[model samples]
Target: MALAFEGKVAAITGGASGIGLATGRALLEGGATVVLVDRDKAALDRLTAELGKNCLAQVTDLLDAESCDAMVPEILERTGRIDILHCNAGSYIGGDLSETNPATIDRMLNLNVNAVMKNVHAVIPHMTERGSGDILVTCSVAGHSAIPWEPVYSASKWAMTSFVQIMRRQMLPHGVRVGQVSPGPVASALLADWPEENLRKAKEAGALLDPSEVADAAIFALSRPRNVTIRDMVVLPSTFDI
Candidate 1:
């Protein structure tokens, strides 16, 4: 059977590593042209080299509106049309509600929530004009079930989940599909910064999920027929709960 993404064009934020990188690879293998955006120039360059000519790497800081605006036009110039968008950039900060500093919370919300909204806003006009597009956001299990020590992180993810849900309904009539994937404890470099104690606790609880697992889920969601929309999906290790 042929891949569903053949001849499609996709734009992915944070596409240099982890789940984002995995998803980009899946899209390319399925015959889609991919625009990979990330903050790390070196990583983007490396990935672009690996993915070859069909992939375009743009060094972008999604936290800034100016950067996102500039990115969409460049993508349009290159690909002409965007068939799918994967808003997958995010960061995790662990702290109790009382210990969370205002600055830390601001940074988390700006990148996790505001950046996703800005990218969506910048891209929607073009998608709506075409009257068809698919949006897949990388939310987290924290959105559905709060993690006690990671209060701010949970809040940011919850906001992303809510935004995707609301947009799915509003965009449906415009011939656009909006969906979200929530992954639990994925094995990525994001875990590198976790405190040793927390890392141990997570491991004791269970093994971390593989990034490819979530990537596969994303591909599945985007490949569904136009009339079939997956509003939300949760991916977790078999041992994970809540």
Candidate 2:
């Protein structure tokens, strides 16, 4: 497993904190060059110091199409190649659909759905041409279920769920693998938008997973033998329900 990641280069969005950060650390320890992609420069600077050599940062705003599109070429220029692309950057907005702010909808959908596709679109050419690469997205259990409380969020994930499936087939013939790691309620910044009662109850019920847990699943998927494709791995806290 260690040898599998050695000499590999991985570009991860939302790489400054949460699951992305955890995965970046794991990959670095395994001898892979990890590119931390996020809009937070301060966090990226701090992480670069802690993560040491093998770790790089791509300070990008996923919400902006041009910024998002430009990251792949930028990383390729810096690293020469990207063996792994983890589309893990995303935002969360919950509660009644009627209450969803117009601007928030644009931001969340753009980040969660559009940015992911745009990033993938940019990488498709390079990976297909090279004839090898692994692409994984940070999906959600919400994507697998309707979860009425957050319809818009679910709607976005549903789009992702379908996109991942179709993209996998498209990339399969090109020797590039595509998949997703869908996790349940994770103790990450995404919960900052969750209601207080919901967060408290999720914690009390032991229903929230740590970012490292999700990172483990992600690495597991990425480390598998080229012949074995882990299309989707859904991880949930043992106590989590629905």
Best by lDDT: 2
- Model 1, range 65-136, lDDT digits (tens) per residue? 788678878888888999998999998887566765788778878889988988898889999999999999
Off by over 4 Å in 2: none
What local lDDT score does residue 163 receive in model 1, on the 0 to 100 scale?
97
TM-score of candidate 1 relative to the true fold: 0.95
TM-scores of all candidate predictions against the true structure: 0.95, 0.98
What are the lDDT figures for the candidates, one per model?
A: 0.87, 0.93
Give the worst 10-residue stretch by lDDT in candidate 1: 190-199
Clashing pairs in 1: none
Question: How many residue pairs of model 1 clash at the backbone?
Answer: 0
